[model samples]
Structure formats: structure tokens, C-alpha cells
Target chain A: MSSRRAPRVHGLMTRGYADDLRLFGSGKAKLGLLALVLAYLMLPFFLTSDFWLSVLDYAGIAAIGALGLNLLTGYTGQVSLGHAFFIGLGAYAAAQLGGPDALNLPLPLWLLGAAVFGALVGALIGPFALRLRGNYLAIVTLGLIFLGEHLFRNLKDVTGGNSGTNVDTTATLGGLDFKDLALLGENFSFNQGYFWLIWGLVGLVALLVKNLVRTRPGRALQAVRDRDVAAEVVGVQLGRYKVGAFAVSSGLAALAGALLGSYQQFVSPDEFSLFLSIQYIAIIIVGGVGTVFGSIVGALVLGGLPGLIDKYSASIPGVSTGSGDSGFISVFSLNQAIFGLLIVLFLVFEPRGLAAVWLRVKAYFKAWPFSY
Target chain B: MSEFLQLCFNGTALGARYALVALGFVIIYRATGVINFAQGGLLALGAYLAYALNDTAALPFALAVIGAVIASGLIGAATERVVLRRMVGQPVFAVVMVTIGMLFILEQTITSIWGFEALNLGDPWGVQIVRAGDVVLAQRDLWTVGIAGAVLAAFFAFFRFSKLGVAMRATAFDQEAALAQGISARRVFAVSWGISGALACLAGVTLAAGPAALSPGIGAVALIAFPAMIVGGLDSPVGAVLGGLIIGITQALTTGYQEDLFGWAGANFAAVMPYVVMVLILLVRPYGLFGTREVRRI
Candidate 1:
């Protein structure tokens, strides 16, 4: 029996609880990680510039939306080309619920309404089209983006048509004005208030998603993704798991949309176009699929890269940041071209994404000083 | 009675164009098992090629058509040899994504050359519409349907009778067997691409003649060809033609009737109607109207 226990695995394995903590399963490591997170959370307060704050706000919104898509595509092996449809649906629901006259409902209720609407709409779209497998599902979802756009453009009364709705900013909760773009206006400004609100929501959502991934439902989703037939054989219901994943993803996407609408104080069809959906998918792929941290990292890279390019290119010699007809227009359009190239290059060379690279670097450092 | 005949005429004409485009998709898919999302981009290339030859190069219409067809054929073959050949054994998903990326590259190239503007290409045969009581029809539309049907028939004859066509078919059916029998599968792939490109050129010419204008958006209509291919049955060429015809006619009728009823004031429904039908049809018959079902052993 002692011979059989002789180091079958090479990792720092131990039987005792304290030994386990010193090796792979360490509470100290987790506490250290939590401390690092706290520092990160505090770092933003030191720099509250309007421009940077606004950028962070948009990045938060994008991360929320991309996280939802990661849940669907990353965990469930489903492809969705119409994710923006759900986002737009949520935005519209938020707008409608808040009402033109501020119908006396709480802000949280309105947000919850948006999420419920998203889940319902997602469930409706899911089972109807997800019955088929492979590229068929992709096409169906892609068509929905078009359909959703057309509906938003044509339904003048409900969706406010192509121009979209200007959501009223009168909703409130517990004597705190919800529509006050600057919650911290006493010290900072409007942009920072929006930034903090978005960041707070992102943190809460991330924690919820982390916990969800460890639960039975999340494991079931992974099983379905890896092998549907095997998962089914093991008593995991395919339709239910897939539909549940869609609902949760859609709900989160809707939350992002609602927040986006609140921040912009407006909602429009163009915000949820096919290009936006493609942008969300590209961010996840570039960030690394199925990773929580990947969503945040991907959002920052996708959102910030173009701005940085334009900012630097304006001063560079021979670089056309402004050429009357040939100069970089807004960094946004240039980013589209770059985005396409990035996806191709990343898929070809770095399929494991930035998170994987980060992991490898950390492991390298940890394994250093031994010189083995 | 004249209205019904006119509807049939219009349906056949529109369907013929879609068939030509869908047929192009089917050829590439049959040979390589890749869903070439770049079909629309290639269609635009064909159209632009013809336009450049006629307007810029100062060639006769007939000569320009031939030049465009040959140029597109070479382009097709080059693409397969260069980009697609590198992705030979990759998963189907990756290959599909590569084609999607190729779409962006093709679009950028065309835009860089042509500028993003709609250009008119004059009719091939100096044609005019023949109007009857309560109905009118263009000679070009008739020519389009006739030419499309003739091309389909010619391709069928080629595959069934010609030695080269048989060789291509053999390669398509089983590359290993074709190689064992001394037929070069790569050469067959090039041939299929060439034929597919020629078909795209024909469709492009017909489309340019219709509105007498071309735009980047024109290539987008090629997306309709995918649904048409699936609706017709991916494995069957004849089904592609029939499927395209059905989709085109249904869309035309829907737009025509909607205009009569609601005065929507646009042809947008005509554009989206085929996709709607495609989704509905896919719901009932995922393999498509004439598509084959594959058996997988786990």
C-alpha cells in the first residue's frame, strides 16, 4: 500500500490540510489575490479625468455584454451573431419601463424588468432556432440581427424608429436620483459617477458569474459543450441546459444594454447593429473564450487600442491622422479594419489568448530561482 | 391572364440570376466541402471586372464579357491555390472563418480600386421592354432566364458527357480514388473554381444589366445564395437552380403584393423575404429540399 502511494503525480501533493494549503490549494494565495483586486479597485479613484472615466465606462458596458456572449459561445459551444438584438431588446425594455413621465417605479425594478424581457426574448429565439446544429444556428442568429435592426427602424411607435428614443432620466430609488449622471458630483463630475456605477455593476456581475461557473448548472453547460451525446447519456438534458445558458447570457446582456441606455440617456437601433454583435464576438475571441478575466482584458484592448492609435498617430511623422481626405477619420472606423486583422492573426497564432499567455508568464516566474 | 404570365416571366428571370449565383456556391462546396461566404465578394469582382473591361479598357461588350469571365476564373483558381490550400486539413469551422476573413479582404480590394459608388453597365444586347395591356416585360429579363437555363443544361451535358467534366466529378466524389486513377484532384479543384467564377460573371452581368448599376451592397445579395443552396439541397446542382427560382419568385411576389396592399414604397421586403422563407424551410427540412442526410457513427 505504501509502494502504491509513491508519488504517482509530480505536482506538490499532500494528505494533510495545512500541506494542501502550502501546495495547490492555498487560502493565502486567494487572500493575496483579493488584496490585489482591492488595489485595482482603488487605483481608479486616483485618476478621475472625464475622458479616461468615459472610456472606462464604455469598456465596462462592453465587458458586460461580452461576458454574456462568452457564457453562450464559450461555455455552451453556441454561436450567436445577433447578440446585439438582445442588447437592443434590453435597452428598449429599460426605456419603456422608465416611461416618458417617470411612472413611479424604482430604478432596480426597471433594471430587473429589462433583464426579464431579455431572458424571455432569448428563450423565444433559442428553442425555435437552436434545434439545428452547426452553421445553421449561426445563420439564423445573423438573420436575427438584421431582423431586429429592421424592426427597430420600422416600428416608429414602439422602438422610436431609426432615430431611437430619448429615455427620460427621472427614475429614482431611496431618495437618490437615478437620472443624476453624477452621483459623485459633490466631489468629482458626471463622467466619474457613470464610471463608478458601471464598474460596480461589472464587479457584482463578475462575482455572480464566477460563482455560477462553479455550480452544478455551469458544469452541466460545460458537459453539453464538450460532448452533447455523452452529456445526454449521463442524464444531462440538452434543451434545458442550452436554453438556461441562453437565458442567463441574454439576461446579462440586457443588463449591459440597460446600463448603456442609462449612461447615454438615449437608446437607438444603430447601437445594436450587426457590426456591434460582430464586435462583441471579436472581443471575446481576442480576449480568450470562456475566461472571466478574458472579458475584461478583451474589452480594454478592443475599446482602447484604436483611441491609443489615433492619439499617437496624430504626432507621428508620415502617419495620416488628419489628411483632409486620407487622414484617420475617428479611430473607430480604422479600428474596424484593425479588428478584422486582429481576429485572423490571433486565431492563427495565439488561439489560447492573452489570459493563457499571462498564466504562462506567472508560472515561469513561480518556477524560476530553481534553475532546473 | 397576362398578369399571371407577366408574374411567371418576372419570377423566372429573377430566379435565373439567383440560380447562377447559387450554382457557383454549390460547385465550390461540392468540390471542397467549404461554405464559401466570399461568393458575394467574388460576384462583385466579376461584375467590376466586366465593368472595367468595357468602360475603362475600351473593349467591345462581347470581348469584355469574355475577359471578365477569364479574369474571375484565374482569380478563383489563384485564391484556392494560395489561401485555401494552406487550410486544407483544418476544421470546417476554421475554414468557414477564413472565407469570412477573405470576404473583408476582397471588399477592401474592390473598394480601393472601384471607389464606393454605383456604376451603370449598359445592356449586352441593346434590349427594350415589350409592354402589353396591364403588364410589361423586358427583353433582357427573358434573355437572362433563357441564358441561365441554357448554361445549366450545358453544365449538365458537360458533367454527363465530357471527359474533363467527368474527371472533375470524379475528383469531387472521391479525391483519393481520383488520384489512384491518375486524375489530379488539385487540377479538378482549379477547374471547378474556374467554372464557378465564370458562372458568377454571368450572374454579375445579368444583375448589372437589370438596374444598370453596381454597388458594394450588390455583393451582399450573394448571401441569398447560401440559403438558396441549402433550400435546393447542397448536394444537388439541379436543386440549386430550382431552389433559386423558388426563392426569387416568392420574394418578387411578396414585394409586388405588399406594394399593392400597403404601398410600402420600397423593395426591402423583396430583399428579406427569401431569408424568411429559408428559415421556415430549414425549420421543417434542415437538410433542405433536395439535400442529403449524412449518417455519423459515434
Candidate 2:
């Protein structure tokens, strides 16, 4: 039996050709990976309860947001600390349009309004912001977060001020009401009601991102990220791509925010703080940059960690969960500490992230006989 | 007319604080070719240390300030030796990101140590008001302006005439050449961080005595220094001061005159004004008012 396995293992290392097992360098491997991902996503519906399904829903929303950031920061090499501002803009636009006393626009138009408005605001700000580089860029964008919050707070008619705006579940896609669990099954709640919608959006965004990377515009973005001066010399319009990336990133972030707002039946300024923006960046950093699969993996790891902590908080002696505050807060602050440490650690030691580590492990198993 | 002069006076006072902070920024940028995002956090730490030392240890205010500055200088030196020194010769983006991560670490540390309360920091000099016709000026504000002026004069002399300062400037110009000439780039790096650290402490002290109480959020004022650097020129020391003055007065005038005209919220606009100016300057003159343009070879 051992001798029978040797040639198979040797074939993995020799591959008969260099490109056969080169990891993401072949279409066969890519298709195999896609099938595996489909199984992983669908497995939850069969194996998990509603609570776990809800966790996956939140992960889907985060993965969408992280995918946007990865496009801008990973593919284009631009840093932004104002991501949550765009998300807030999208969420509030939808809420205001569909609120009880809002202009009471149709649901489809309202969602479109959120994305278009976010892109416009992004373009307007990008001209000014795209000039800054390095930490200066980060600082300027961070300032925008504060400015956005202040603007929202001061504009009472639009944002409802600090008290925040709430929706009564009236906004939905056609007759598919978000709160109507009956549409799904007798056993399903609204959280489970959102399971399919969030994943469908994730799948759509992932496909869109994957296709974008293969287009000419995507090639130009990658070129600029690799070397701006060289890209400019090759007839790539640096300014256009810089602004375009921000617009796309902001529009996607808004899309996620809209989904979140509709799912929760509420949208508030506090929900879209700088912390959320940072968390999104952290998600992408842990995820493989510029890869769709990385976004999903990163979102699951970072998003699920806190939920795990909340569930197990009571089991850990001397770890006060701070019950008066949301069980989420006490655990999440610890998560922030861990996340910050992870970024530093990843940058210094394993900058390629968990995806890179997983690839290494897979390679070792495939090439077991030779171990070369 | 008097109210106008007083607005200018208050503007200059705020400008002086901005200049001190921007000077720290310029020093590090010129020497290390990296913007120290942690400067604001360092300033806040310095201010908090002074407050803590005076309140907790029951030390005299003057002695506490001295101790605080010393602590800040040590922090700066340690950061250079450990964090920044390791990052030497790395790509600009990587180094910049490290500094940002440093900012996150420092912000959390400050929050952990001080909690979130804003504290009223009293002036070293007793509070007194002087009237100039229709306007009023605080004695502490005058002190801030005077001290800032003195610090500027001293910095000029140190950089122009002193030996170590000349060596620092030489290292800033060409680090490898300076190293070839037997001037220790490491020492130059240390001295730059030390001086910058001291300036941050000075700015923190004076700012603590301003209109608002000292809080961790005061680091937001770093935005003012950022635009001032761009306006003054990144490489020019004198430009930093001039830029600070211009930015300060422009913000004051806008708040004073443009508020009613534009139906804008004055204070919020004041916060954003520097960034708006920074964007304009960056577009029109990338080298800024006093900065030297560089050739990119790719």
C-alpha cells in the first residue's frame, strides 16, 4: 500500500509539468476550488442552526465590505479611513428615502439612490484626497470620518441627528418583506430570512470583483499599484484610475450598508463609526489582498472570533462580560486589541496572511514523498 | 477695528501652538523622510504625563513639565531605536504603515492610562485678561506667542550655527554621504527624534492652556499642522512657522466673516479648512510654498 502511494505523491511534486500544481496558476485548480467553496457555503444550511446561519449572514455583509477595501487598498494601493462614511451615506440615504415620513420612494429606486449617491460623494472627495500619500493619506481620510459624523449629526432633517433614524420594516424587495419569515419556512425567523439574500449579494459582488480583475481597467489598477510612474508612462491615466477605484469601493461599501440597514430595520450614525471602518480594513488585511476568496476567509475569521468570545465569555472565569453593555462590546474591545496585534504580527512575520499559510500546508501534503 | 485685531491676536496664539507641533513634524520628516503620525499621540502622552506627575506625585508644575518632556524624549528615542530604526531602508509605504500602526498602539495606551475624561490644565502663569479697545486677550495666550517666538529663534540658531545641527542638516541632505564623512547617522537620528520629542512637549503644554481642556482627542489638531506643513513647504523649517501663521489667520477670518455669509457651521469648517487648503496647494504646487521638488526615477 505504501509503495502504491509513492508514484502518486511523486507525481504531485513533478506534476509532469510546472504549471499543473502551481497553485492558482491553472484553470482546472481554480474550478476545483470554486466547487469546494460552493460546498462550504451551502453546508451551513444543512448542518447548522438558525443562530449559526445568522453568523454567516453577518459574515457575508462584512465580506462584501472587505472586498471593496481590498479593491482600493490591495489592488490600487490607496489607503482610506473614511470607508464607514460611505457606508453610512448609503444606509442613511435608503432609510431617509424609505422612512415613514421620507419621500417614500420605491424600494429599488431607493437602493439605487444609495449606491449612486455614494459614488458621487466619493468622486467629489477623491480629487482632493487622492493627492495625499502614505500616512498623510490615512490621516486625511480619518479626518473625513470625523467630518462625516459631524455633518450627519448637524443635518437633523437628513440623518435625524444623534437620536438616529429607525425603520418599521416597510421597505422590501417587491412583496418579499424582510420581516416576513413565512416566505422562507415555518421554522425560520427574520435572521434566517436574511440568510439567502446576504449570501446572494456576496456571490454577486464576488463574481463582479473577479470579473473586474480580468478587465483592462483592472490591469491598469494593478499596474499603478506596482509602480505609478511606470504606469503613467505607459498611458495609464493615474488620476482617473485613482478616483475610479474610490468610487467603486464607496459604492460597494454603500451596498453593504444598505443591506445591513434593511436587515436590521434601523440605521444609526454610531453603527458606522471609524471603528467599523478600521475593522473592515483589518478584515481585508487578514484576508488575501486582491483575491475574492481572501475576503470571504478573512470575514469569517475576524467576524466569527467575537461571536465565539460572546458565547464562551461566561465559561472563562474572571472574564467579566460587562453584561450591562452589549455582550458584544466587552468581547469586541478585546478583539480590537487582538486585531491590532495581528496586523503588526502579520506585517512583520506572515504578511501573506492565512491564505498563504493554508497554501503551504496543502503543498506539503501533496508533495509528501519527496518533501522538496 | 479692535475686535479685528483681537481675532488676529487669538489667531496668532493658536498659530503659535500649531507652529510648535508642525516644527516637530518637519524635523522628523526632513531627517527620516517619514511622517510621524504618532506625534499627536506623543504630544497627548506628554500632556497627560505632566498632568499625572503634578497630580499624582504632588510635584511642582515646573518640575512636572520638565519630567514630562524628558519622558517624551526618551519615548521618542526608544521609538527610533527600536521601531523606526528597524524600518530603515524599507519601502516608504511599509514604514508609513508602521507609523500608523504605532499611532493605533499609542492611542490605546493613552486611553488605557488616562481613561476618557478631559481634564482642565491650568496655566503656569496666573490667569489675567488685557483689553485692547473692544477686544480681550488672555495673559496665557500672550505667553504662548512669546514662548513660541523664542523657541523659533533658538531653533534657527541651533540649525544654522551649531555643529550637531549642521551635521543633522548634512544627514538630512544625504545620509550615505554624511555616513561616509564619519558623521554617525544613528546619532543624527537619535538627536532628531530627541529634539522633535521636546518640541511636541512644548506644544502640548501650551495647547493644554488654550480655550479647551486637554483631552486625547486634541490629537485631531494634528490636521492643522499637516496643512501648515504643505503651505509652508515640507523641507523648509521657516515655511512651517509661516504656514502655521497663515493657516491660523485664514481659519480665524473664515470663522469670523464667512460663517454668516455661507450659512456654514464655523467651528466644523475651521476643522476642515486646512485639508481643503492642503488639497488646493497639493494640486497647484506639489512641492508646497517652500518645499523642494524631487525627480522620480522609475
Candidate 3:
């Protein structure tokens, strides 16, 4: 009976397209997901440190932005160094719609408003993508960052100019303020409360993106990314899909920006630079291009790294935590150097990124003994 | 009229620097099909290297500039050999990001060594000006324009006559065919990067020699050079020079007239004028003024 059962369990062989598209293809995947969910629920309670909680929270925010970028550059094959522009747009939108001396809307409304605004702007820019290809498009998008910076700095009434504006957007939703959560008669710190809120959204966004990428539209996107001309020959409406991808990607970026602004409680023009856009690009690259899960993995690793470094700077040799310290390199320079090194090393050694490594490990175990 | 003339002179000088930088971009882009984002880092490195040679090593100004250029060229060649040579046949995005990665690393390394403080390059050209019919031009600006012109002429002649230059052009035109013709693609690539580095060094020294002190922000001039290269056409050397001049003049005029005529655009509108002009020009000519239109095959 045991020998017969061993033959019967041929291990999640796909018989059809639906099986291929299954989110959890095997019992192991389901178990892995369960473990993830359990960890998400229990980790905050176990750790209970504000510093680590905030780091995780920031990582979740980065994951959201990286997911958006992956959709654009990774999946759609559109290289944009202008993500920071849309992010800035969203931050200022939040400032106007939800901050003090403004309309003061609730959390959901402002976030949605920012997304809508970003989508509109993205739509306006999408026509250029239709005309230009490759390097031209990249450079034009780069111009958008400078143009956006100019607008942000000049629009003092809305953005509060160079000094930046305070974001008083409350995280309250249906009488449950994430800034000070009262859950099951237990009061949690702001960081603890925010971790749940941010990570929950991360899960939601991840699920949404995963579902999108698995469906017909997702196939169309990948098709366009691989070869736009061939995709067009196959009767894919090039303009609609291209514009739609832009709108969706920028909308997600804007949503992430809204979260970032509210979380930091300050929205500044300086915060949105070309470097920030590069950081998002790096995350998607390091995580795994064309894989939704890679975005979160990248964010968790790269996003949490800076904070960890800052916290342990005192212990690290040859790194000055403060100005006028006895060190050759400042913390800022060290961080920049690390980011650069990570990008170079990852592209050179493992172009497929962390997700590929994870898949390899899984494949090794799955093919145990057979070695095929 | 004199003020306008002065602005034009200043713009021309600025454009000369931009042309040098844009020309460097064209060389690398033409040969390897990779946009070297690290050019800015190279520019900074060159300027700083010159500073070290001149001030620290007590070399003559010309000797320091030559030494810096040679050192930067070697570094550029080594980068191509070590990192980018392996990236041959990779996707354009990946290659571009690699350069960007190099850029960040180079920038931070410079900052770590040099710190953030601005320092004079100690060039012979101080703040002295030469007046010509009510228009005052800095002596350094004149030298910049003169040197840029000479270099551009020499490069064009090299491309027209030299064997190695012809080989590089052949590689740029058709890599497989060039290889079939027995041209060493690796040597061409390394040589292209070296030339680009030397050009960047020249641009850096010229820009930092005048009133503008050498600082970390000197690298950012390469960002402005992007508009010049794009406006002229990415693959065209002559186009890059023309684009640089157009962008430089427009920027100068914008700075001179913004307060009086276009205050609504905000302060320092001149800073972004290159981008504005680039976008407008790109709208009309998607391939740029001199860029070859890409031919697609099914």
C-alpha cells in the first residue's frame, strides 16, 4: 500500500492551464503560505520593539513602491527613473487632501485621491511612451523628475515649498486609529500598530498584483515586454495596454507615497530625488524582475538594511555615525557605497536576483534523490 | 546689447564644456551601445585627481591635467574590461543599471576621500577678464572654447583618417561584420571607454577651473549634458556639440531674462531650461536632430 501511494503522489504535476495558474500549486506551497501568515500575525507581538517594528513598516512601504516599479520596468519593460516624481505628486496630494490647513479627509479617501491624481498624470505622460522607444523614453522620463521637482518647489501653497509641509493625515479607519491602536482591550505603540496596517496592505497589494499577473491582462503585459511588435501582431492593443500599465503602476506608486508621507508625518520635496527612484529600481532588480514576490523580498532585505546599519553604526569600524568623528567614511557615504555595491554584485553574479535563489533551493528539495 | 553679448559669450563657453561631455557620451554609446551613467563620476574623479596631482604632488597645472586624464582613461578601460566586458549581450536595462551602480560607487568614493568642502582647482586662470567692445569675457572661458574646438577638430580628423578610429566606426556600425573583418571588438570597446574618460577629464577641468569651485556637485554637470546629447542625437558626435550649444545658449538667455519676462515660472527657471528644450525638440523629432531612426524587423 505504501509503495502504491508513493507512485500516486507524483508531486503537483500540472495537467492544464488552470493547474499551472494555481496560486498554491502544491501542499508545500500552501504550508509555506500558512507559515508566512502565522509569522506575520505573531512576529509583532513577539518582537515588540519600536525600532524593529518601524523598520518592518518602512520595508512594507518600500515593497508597495517596488511592486509598482516591477510592474512598469520589470514586467512592461519600460525603464522609468521618474518614479520619485509620481511619489512626490502623491505626497503633495496627501498634504492637500488630508493634512492640516486642508480638506482633512480620512485615510482611505486621501490615499485613493492620490492614486487617482497619479493615474491622471501618468495618462498624460503615456502618449510619449507610444511615440518614443528605449533610450529616448528613459531620458524623457528622467526629465519628468526635474520638472516635477521644479513644480514641487514652486507650488508653495500646496507643497509648502523647499522646507516641506507637515502631514497630519490621521490613520483612523472606522474608529480604529493605527497611530494608537486599541485592539482587544490592549493598547499598542504607534510602531506596533503601524506594522499591522502596513503589512496587511502589503499582503493585499501582493495578492492583487499576483492575481493580475496570472490572468489574461498579465499575459498581455509580459507579451508586450518580451516583444511589443510581435505582441501587436497578435492583436494586442498596444496603446491601451501600455497606457493602462503606466496608470496602474503610477497609481500604486502614489498609494505607496501617501503611506510614506503619513507614516513619516512630513512630506518634503527633497525626499523625492532621482536617488529615491534608483532605490526602487534597485529593489526590483535585487528582489527579482518579473516576479511579484521578489519585490517584497527585496524591500525586506534592502529597505530594512539602512535602518539596521544606522542602529549599529557605533559598533561598525571605519564608519562615522556623527560629523567630525574619527572615521574615513560617513554613514551616508557608506550607505550609498553599499547600495552601489549590491546593485553591481547582484547584476554581475545573480541577474535573476533573490527570488531565483529561493526557487533554486525549493527545486533542489523537490527533486531530491532523482537529481534530474 | 553688450549684456546680451556677454550672456551669449558665457553661454558659448558653457556649451563648449557641455559639448565635451556630450562627445564623451557619444563615443561610448556609439561603440558599446551602453549609456555610461558613470561619466559623471569619471568627470568628478578627473577633476579631483587633477587637484591631487597639482596641489598634493606639486606638479605643473598642464602636467596635472594630463596625468589626471591618463589615470581616468586607465580606470575607464579597466572598468570596461572587468565589469562591462562580461555584460556583453545583456539587456540594455541591466547594462544601464550597472553603469548607474558604478556611478553611485564612484561618487561616494570621491566624497569619502575629498569630503564635501569646495576647493579651488588652482588653475592659472583666476578671475581675470578680457574686455572686447563693452563685453567682458573670462580668460578661462576663452581657453575652454578654444581647447574644445581644437579637440573636436582633432577627433573628427581621427575618425576620418585613423585606422583604429575606422575600426571603432566599423564596430559601431555592425559588430558581427566588423568581427568578421578581423577587428578586435574588445580593443575597440576599451579604447572607446578610454577616449570617453579623457574627454570627461577635459570637460571637468574646464568647468572647475573658473569661478566654479571643484566640489561633489561638479559631477552633476553631466546630468545637464544628458539633455545636450539627447537633443543632438545620442549617436552623433557633431549633433552632440550642436545640441550642447543650443541648450547652453537657451539656458543662458533664460537666466538673463527670467526675472524680467518669465517670473511666473519661478526662480532659477534657467536650471531646468535644458530639459524643457529637450522635451520640446524630442516631441517634434523623436529620433532627435541627428540620431538614426531605428529600423525594426519582424
Question: lDDT tens digits, residues B1-298, model 3?
Answer: 9999999999999999999999999999999999998999999999999999999999999999999999999988999999999899888788888998899999999998999899899999989899999999899999999999999999999998999999999999999999999999999999999999999999999999968889988998998999999999999999999999998989999999999998999888898899999999999998789999888655
Task: Please provide, for model 1 over A80-149, each residue's C-alpha lDDT reduced to its tens digit, 9 standing for 90 to 100.
Answer: 7778999998888877787666453467888888888898888887795446655567667777877777
Model 2 ranges with Cα > 4 A deviation: A1-55, A97-109, A129-136, A167-178, A183-185, A304-339, A369-371, B89-91, B120-123, B132-134, B254-259, B265-267
Off by over 4 Å in 1: A1-36, A102-104, A169-186, A304-333, A369-372, B86-93, B122-127, B132-134, B162-195, B260-267
Candidate 2, residue B73: lDDT: 87
DockQ values per model: 0.33, 0.35, 0.76
Pairs that clash in candidate 2: none
lDDT of 3 by residue, A186-275 (tens): 888889878888888899889888998899999999988888999999988989988988888898889888888888989888889888
Better of 1 and 3 by TM-score: 3
Query: lDDT score, residue A64, model 1?
Result: 89
Displacement of the residue A62 alpha carbon in candidate 3, Å? 0.2
State the lDDT of candidate 2 residue by residue for A1-372, as single tens digits. Answer: 555554434322445543442335455567887996686556644644766776777788888888888888888888787899988988887787666677677667777777788888888877754566655566567767877877777777778777887754354676665555444354445666577667767888887887787678988999988878899999999899999988888888887777777766777778777668767876776776666778888998886666666788777653447655332224544555566666655665655667787788878877787688
Q: What is the TM-score of chain B alone in each candidate?
A: 0.93, 0.95, 0.99
Candidate 2 lDDT by residue in tens digits, B1-298: 8767877988898888889888888898888897777787788888888888877887888888889989988888888887788777655545655665666666666765665578866546556778767888888888889989998999989999999999989999998899999999889888888888878887888888645677877766765687787777777898899889888887776677666777555235766677667666777876778887765666
**Against the hidden reference, what TM-scores do the models get?**
0.86, 0.86, 0.98
Question: What are the Cα lDDT values of the candidates?
Answer: 0.76, 0.75, 0.90
